[model samples]
Target: MLSGGSTGVGLTARDELESTISLARTADKRGFHRFWMSEHHGMGAASVSSPPLMIARLIAETTRVRLGAGGMMLPNHSPLLIAEQFGMLEALAPGRIDLGLGRAPGTDGATAAALRRGADANDGFPQQVLELLGFLDDDFPSGHPYRQVHAVPGPWQAAENRVSTPTGTPQTWMLGSSPYSAQLAGQLGRPYAFALQFGDADVDTAMRLYRENFQPSDALAKPHTLVSVSVAISEDPAEARRQAGTSAMAMLRMFKREGYLLLPPDEVQAYQPTMQERHILDAYTDRSFHGTPETVADRLEDLHARTGADEVMLVVGGHCASLDREGISLIADHYAMPRSEIPLPVAAQ
Candidate 1:
């Protein structure tokens, strides 16, 4: 997943947002199967508040790469709206759109409250997911409140127009950092994405739960798991650690509720951390995959072997766009991912 997030060390919001496009193009050219943007609200460091809008822009710039929200926080918006947005995206990209839904707020408590408008939306995530599926498929049960309200540009839209979209609706995946989400995804028979970068959740346990509880669905015959991890790769191991430290510092600040902006490695080195802060920072850095491409690749391979994840999504951490892109290229080269001969299309200015 090429996240729409930046460290915000020395870059403007516009620079970071535009850099996401460049990164997406690189991911596409290098044959990364999916390029997913994340949704984060009221965060200075994360400029992407709307994944669908970014996906739309990416669709125009890249060819062959699957574009998706790595994910959209479901509690913040109406399920029908999400259905319509992703439904339209599926229409545009055919088999290339994924809708990864998460129950978390993806923001602080105050920001989440503002987004939810005093409603307790998180608890209804499962129901909302079902409603969203119903809207996308137009298959609500009789007497259901939303049975008559169809999501335009959805499967119903194609049927109404007699348009043949053999590619089908947007592929939905469940995203979470806990067992609850793992079980939910399994019960629904949806692909599950465990975000190991954000929290200290046990990937082994989560994957076990997902597969053990798995039920077959139309989209997937068996359990499909994607593990997303934070990674920073460079020719120099020390340089990779430095880049990784920038993100670790940013995460530390967010944990302390101080700020979300990422500082440069120099700044991170200059500041003296408290003993407790050092422990927290170390824990964050320890779980991340950082070092030379060979080292990171070995770690990623080990993780995949342990968890049996169908896909491993790298949350590449770096202080600059060039570094991030370079890290991506290095990892792709290490894995021997196929590259496209066609040049990436430049986004409209």
Candidate 2:
């Protein structure tokens, strides 16, 4: 599971991210495979504008968990810059980095326009992805425009990346909520991750297409996949609903162009929702998996079996770090994930 550090309506921004790191320390010990953050800009609700910076901070704070972006909107910056930033992360924590790519701006139209000025990222995503790989691999073809260019920390690239070596590159995946990206990932022979958190996209069809069209390559001899979902689980069903409600309200606020932050379930309960709004909320809640750990795990297992997903990433619903951390512990326990025996640092205490 990953949190972009959803800063609640009244909470301080620092707490949102710092607390995720706090949870990451727990995730490190709990044997979670990876810790990733989302990239959003010009939003008061989310403080994770620079995922690379956060990933670096996470590397310094914990050991063992692979850190990277849930995605970085590639069109917003130079490909070489992304390569160098991740190259540095690979340098800091050799085999512990992932680079998930998303075409979405991760922001509103005005903000995205401001970020791109005029370039259309959606149109250039494929080319940009290839360019990024070339730089990261230092394999631009003969006489190519950027043939001579090399990403810094250039010595540590895919060619030299191995568990036997201290330096390694990130595990790259194309992230999407649609089949287009799924097909593209297959065509490129890269790993694919589909987001089922939104509730609207048909992840099953997308994943099926990815697997069907997959072309084996050096990076992956077969299709490697992961699916992301929105979930909230608790022994008490009502409590589970309340936790999931916070996320529903947060999303409602986002859609309405209102304030963008998680709201306590109490507030949501007290506020009067229109009939249509209530219906939407009800539908969304029904779509999410929630209950006891056993119940939730069973549902997740079914999803895993149905989608044939090699890995499952979660976006836990909550209003604070404690709720998210508790969610992590439950899921980790069910999966029998690894745990660290070391005690918390004095400062953390």
For model 2, residues 148-183, the per-residue Cα lDDT tens digits are 787876554433454345345788889998989999
Which sections of candidate 1 miss by over 4 Å? 1-4, 346-349
lDDT agreement of model 1 with the native: 0.86
What TM-score goes with each of the models? 0.96, 0.93
Residue pairs with clashing backbones, model 2: none
Cα lDDT, all candidates: 0.86, 0.82
* Candidate 1 residue lDDT tens string, 222-301: 99999999998899999888888888888899988987877888998898999999988788887789999999989989
Error of 1 at 222 (Å): 0.7
Give the range of the ten consecutive residues with the poorest summed lDDT in model 1: 340-349
